[model samples]
Target: MKASLLSAAILATAIVSVTACKKDKSTPNYAKADDFMASHAIKEQSFSGNAAAGFTITGKDGTKVTFSPNAFVDGNGNVVSGNVTVTLKEVLSKKDVLFSGVMTESNGQLLESGGEILVKAQKDGADLRINPALQNDGARVEIPKAMNKKDMGLFVQDKRQQGGATGGNQPQQSPYTWNPAPYYPFGNGPNSYSFSLPSFTWVNCDRFYSDPNPKTTITALPAFQDNNQVTDLQVMLVFKNITTVITLPYDFTVQKFQSYQNSLPIGLQADLIIIGKDSDGYIQFGTQPITISANMHIDAPIHKATQAEVDAFLATI
Candidate 1:
């Protein structure tokens, strides 16, 4: 009888010890990590995560991203702190993309739960909003608030076109299409006096010279695309169901709200149409316009393009 009792006691103690260890140990929340990887366009096929080891993933562009063992939290939101590393072997092997950051346990919980809330509410995917400054140091974007990824995708494509990527790819198909000049954002007519608002000078091409000028044609020129240079003859802002026509010399400015009788929200998007004769004498050009939000306070940088520059661009197009 004593031997049986001793065995029972040992078994009970062993059970208690095992339970304690289980309580003390925690594993990574694989689901949350997987969601993060997918949202960033990173491939999660090779993902490996656990309490005893680290987390890792490969991006679509063949970049490798890894988190230290404790970089993630468990099911209950407790952070597991470990070393974090990022490798861009195929993306930027020669360039350095190293980053470091610190996240308190509370912060991790907030971020994790925030993402969950967004995915549920949006039905569509969400974009983790990290502070722009954090993006500078190679730190992965700090997932704060989530943005509607579809809307943001449109926004980024517009930005690329405005930055002279017009010839790189066809304009993305969207219900609302507005094209800003590949050279400049704002238009300033000859001798404008509104110094507070800025205007960008752009080259307007004339593929079909009319009147006294002779039309010049390049026999060896490549096929025409939307990238041809054009001047800003007129621009109009369409938003809040109101169309505000801006003639020669207009400021894509914060004051645009006044046109709506102050009915426009601060961050609301406005579609723009720029009608001007291209170098070929064809009236063709339109683009989406960005908002004059807080980020664009005072004035945004001006982009200028010349007629010669426009011709040079056409040659390549």
Candidate 2:
């Protein structure tokens, strides 16, 4: 029942209060950000179809994907046929991006993401793949225009390092990175950005963050109740002047969340948000307005948050 972000200008104060407001009866005490997202973010949609006849599926947000006949192939290079299940998860907003923990970047370059979608198919219980014959513009994906898609190109998940706690319980994480997606012509229609995807994986519509402004590194410090007890906190930089969101990774060596070197543009305005679970298993968040300066640092004092409060705050981003 706590509605702090809506009428309260979604955290109107700089360095907003970072103390617990009491856990909402509906919010669970989760120890990991992955667990929180799995329970609360958008759920995947599945459709039953036959690979021999082809099928088309749409997401809850109007994301459309079409699989051609015999498009699915199983391991050992066998073509799958009947009873194939196609799954899709659409991440279209800043809220979805954060809760889903999907990062938008390519080989260390920042991206202003328009949206992202996970397309997958399976036969019975085994994983399937797109036939090599159709790997080049074989399957088509059309994401509805929800946010700005200017200069957006196709990008796909190329690699990701393992995440979770290290041997010493030091929470370790490396956000997955995307690469210049395959040459599957990108088009911007009136209502959607249409492109062809060769295989089943994560596809993102993103544009390289191009700015000539002088860049610098930015660091964030999370206010921990126990001083330095590491939790599942997630920190992100949300740009006010442009549609860009980048997650800051925790530097266990320095005990701070930091971004890429020479990444932030000097003089640009932005809001830094730190939200995740506490060591005690309660959801907490902090927000502060900031102007990028040379070697800038931010100290975010996080407070308790309910599921509803989390949703409202994400909507504003």
Candidate 3:
């Protein structure tokens, strides 16, 4: 716990302010950490095609998506035929996952994710759905394969578990889990991982995190000297040796960040990261290295940082 907490403390210190900061519409001085994250998020790739003929588009990141002919249907179940638009948001790396933030856990079990993608379609100013009967398998998606693991299976993200903030865009900070999917990916060699569309919202390649060490909970406290300056706060755990990342949910009752009970492997080495948007719209960050231990309460630091510095740290991940 101390190991992860220390890292969080370090990240809390990298606070940066800029006119470019994003503020929530509801509040004048308040900005959400999620909004900050989304501001620097990876750009979405868009494509256009007629629903009757279908189309395919490849993202700069090498994510390939195909829309089969008559693949989409209206809310009334009528086959859509006019020009349709599609957007793809691909998260292929650990840093990408942090920004897109499709969390890695299901039923309290940690997951190791390879990649994730959110695909959506629009027709004539309205949303559309995949026609499962005609295009369940016809809607093919291929994500660039970075690391291939035979255990890496398909999973779907559930927004219902997001603890309410499911309306706008994907919540940057949610404790949702990824449900294991029966669908499998082909082309597991080197180029990419290919699979048919299972369900749209969010999909990824993931497997349960395995370890022989005992598991325990870790606690992190990002005690900013001027608590009033902080608005949106986020605590994160980055596994050093494994391809896994976790967003520690804040415990309002205790006024600190905490991990899932018995979710972390004892002796596991991880870096704790804390990020918050100050009331003035400045972004703060800190990081520290820690090794898991029993009954730990890690403390963090408070310092200023620049947007360049923050981007540098994210690039290292």
Which digits, one per residue and each the tens of the lDDT, describe model 1 over residues 1-317? 99999999999999999999998886522222223223433111322334225454544443233333343333344443333222221211101100001100010010101111000000012211212222222121112122111111000012222312222222121222122223322212232100110111111110110122221110011122456565434433333222122211232342221121212235544444333445544444333445534323221111223343323422321
In candidate 1, how many clashes are counted?
Answer: 16
lDDT of 3 by residue, 226-269 (tens): 56577666788877877788887776655667776677888888
Model 2 quality (TM-score): 0.80
TM-score of each: 0.18, 0.80, 0.80
Ranking by TM-score: 2, 3, 1
Which candidate model has the greater lDDT, 1 or 2? Answer: 2
| Model 3 residue 34 lDDT score | 56
| lDDT (10s digit) by residue, model 2, range 1-317 | 36756657656542253323432334454334455567767788988887888888888899988878888788988877788988889988766776667776554457888898998888778888888877654478889889674767888887643332122222234545777764778888878899988578888888888889998877888875444354666898878867677788777877778776676778988779987665656677778889999998887787765566666666677
Of the candidates numbered 2 and 3, which has the greater lDDT value?
Answer: 2
Candidate 2: deviation at residue 95, Å? Answer: 0.8
Better of 1 and 3 by TM-score: 3
Q: Which stretch of 10 consecutive residues in model 3 shows the poorest summed lDDT? A: 164-173
How many steric overlaps are in each model, in order?
16, 0, 17
lDDT (CA) for every model shown?
Answer: 0.26, 0.74, 0.73
